[model samples]
Target: MAETRVKSFVLRFLLAQPLTYWKLLKYIDVDIPTVQKTLKNLLRNKILEYKNNLFYLTSKGREEAKDLGISVFNSAMCPECHGKTVTLSPFKWLVKEFESLTFERPKAISEYDQGYVDSTDTVARVIFMYQLGDIEGKNIILLGDDDLTSLALLASGFPKQVTVLEIDQRILNFIEKKAALKGWNNLEVIRYDVREPLPDQFKGKYDVFLTDPVETIGGLRLFLSRCVEALKGEGSIGYFGLTHLEASRQKWWNIQKDILEMGFTITDIVRGFHTYLLERDDILNLELKVVKEAPVEIKIPEVDFYTSNLFRIYAVNSPQPLVRGKVDWQRELYYDQEAYVTCP
Candidate 1:
């Protein structure tokens, strides 16, 4: 049943244009292994062909797409906002400053499953938070700081306090050094592993929480649970990024269910709102399984295609976390069947 849906999706997507593995992976809502298997089956049946590092439907595939009621058409999004549903024009200076400040920042390491959105996206996030009245004079807590969103928030000088809880020592050091250099008295950086108990000092101590969590059931629950622990009470807000590339519809349903159980009501979700910046070197070094097991040798990606939807949820009542105390998830926290990009 799932395989049939993936096949139909791939066929219809190809009707738009030929796409590379990276592009297909970015747009597909299924798991990596399933996608790879579908591609193999399509090729075996001569419904798809690989050429010049791009995959497109064959003659039979086109007929199959016609049978599936697929049509060729072009869809356009707001070019100015790039479908983020927010404009970055107002935050141009902030984006420039953020780019300079983070130019020499630490590189993303796979050990912590770390990656960050583009500098413009970072500032755009701040703009969105500000528009929502969650920024000015509000206590903000970031469950993870790989994106260095704390820096952008501090640069804006809107938040009363910004606290970063990260397990990465390098990130902690980088944020701490910059905060001291700029004399950001209200900014705090703490070395925290999410598996540990929520620190008493941080519990119920924030007005807003932000995180780009690992996209596994256990990881999502753990990350959001910790964020929920930080919120002061009802009306406190939370923002996080979720990706279709890593999470399927079923997984999304599970996550939404978990969020409701935590006493938070999801207010908004902007698809493709966050885009990660990955250099050629970053991709080559990450050792992704899709690249390793490609039917054809995958070329270096020419664009930043990895993206996620930004979710904004607010506590309707006193938030109730699903997990508490010290519980180690070990490999389960970082790698799952759907985690194709994560190194196993």
Candidate 2:
């Protein structure tokens, strides 16, 4: 997909500039024959029309670009975080627009946009409910107002009644106006601090509940436990955590463990970043950065069963030798174990 995009970009420019053989071949990373082959393919497919030595994108190609362009969205430089890159999904776009439209005035939301708090991903909000299958007419609650996850659900023509429980009235008022403007019959906004136990009226009445708690705080357990408390026997709860450089996958597992212990089934999984649509390639094995700083005389630490109750690797220079001449610890200790997985 990326290659095709790069080729499309190069073609658009070449068509505009009518790059000479030398310049076309010299300026772009792709070779002359390769660029010519792409140009020929585009000409054959009627995506680009060649007349004389000049090439131009055809009406069909222009139309297609326009259609694809509908999915593109822009942000105002993220005024706070200064993170420039953003994902290109339309659903993700609407979630962002919906949230900004819904919470443009709150002090907390202002803080969030300023990066005083953390930014949340809208795609993740939808996906959590989406991965669980249908929610039409299902009772739902969202603790935070980032992108109005529940509001998006209402607009999707599903979720019978969405009860958004938020602390900020300015945010709530914004959502209420949005619901009224859209004529959404099933959406409701409530003012409540989710940190407290769920109100008596909400207990066992919800079908789906989720939280994107105050970022970086340890309030996840409390919020999740409240969601669990408000859920019916078969209800589901989803929550998100902000994991920066301090945590690893093992720590995420610990988070999952804690959630499971709170009495909700922890089966489905989703991962995302604030502004960027994350990919597997983003995870770098940064162990070398730490290892490069240690003293020369220092020895790699051994796995202490209790102390290293997380992922473990025995020191290569341990005091004791293996029981036999050698032992395959990788296979014996954690083959196929997810907790100890290396990057693929």
Candidate 3:
């Protein structure tokens, strides 16, 4: 089953671009040895040609892909920026429309657990959610709203109700004030922490839940478990952001396994989907611009490297057993060696 899945994925991906082994490794979820064997099989079958360490589909492979009803060549490829991960190709129009939306940026405070993507990314996310049939009249709950996603959903006149469960009072206040200013009575904000049990009023009340959780294993588990508690039974959808930078393949493997064990199956992983805005007082922003000369003269790279992949998971059944009792909130969330950034 895994081999068949890998074969179909490779055939579909080759229609997008010629792939190097390393690039394929980054994107595919399978083990390297398995990928090697699959590549060998395709090569032996005269389906692929590997040159300069990059893999390309042969004529036979293209014909096979066509027979399977997959488009072998794309005429709409962007000539200037010709890659999936970096270029905002299919989403460019939506992102441009999102540029006009406005929201207050949350202050970077680890204590309040406040870190957010900008309005553009939030709109991009909202658009994706809408595309997935989560539009107007469905009940949606936001596990956290540092990004003010509830406001975005409300502004679009979609969703029957937008409930937010947040630990930060500032965010709660801001969302309420903005929602009122827009005269959107459907938006609701509640102060709640994932470390504690989900409120009775919220349990099994939502059609969907959206979050961008802390990448720590415990943190993610706690956050998502709460989402499951809030979600309605089977077919309820969940959306969250997970990054390759902070979570290694091993961590991703473990997280995905845990999610499936809890009855949600991953449906889509849109790569490089979340882009963060740099703020003036952002710690990394300040560090990036500073020129340091001590044992070495070093300057930060002139590029925005911060991003997260959008993961959409579907509930296969009512959420599995809930993690009873309050989680230890003081647990070391960022101490893991796989943590990409240092945090207090």
Per-model TM values vs. the true structure: 0.93, 0.47, 0.69
Off by over 4 Å in 3: 1-103, 110-113, 278-281, 284-297
Give the Cα error of residue 167 in candidate 1, in Å. Answer: 1.1
In terms of lDDT, the poorest run of 10 residues in model 1 is: 278-287
In candidate 2, the residue pairs with backbone N, CA or C atoms under 3 Å apart (3 or more residues apart, or in different chains) clash, namely 137-160
TM-score-superior candidate, 2 or 3: 3
Choose the strongest candidate by lDDT. Answer: 1
On lDDT, the stronger of 2 and 3 is 3
Please write out the lDDT profile of model 1 over residues 277-312, one tens digit for every residue: 755565666777756766568888876767889999
lDDT of each: 0.87, 0.46, 0.70
Q: Please rank every candidate by TM-score, starting with the best.
A: 1, 3, 2
* lDDT at residue 268 of model 1 (Cα atoms): 91
Off by over 4 Å in 2: 1-124, 215-217, 235-242, 246-253, 273-344
lDDT of 1: 0.87
RMSD of each: 1.9, 19.2, 9.4
Query: Cα lDDT of model 2 overall?
Result: 0.46
Candidate 1 stretches with Cα past 4 Å from truth are 1-5, 282-287, 293-295
The window of 10 residues in a row where model 3 has the poorest summed lDDT is: 288-297
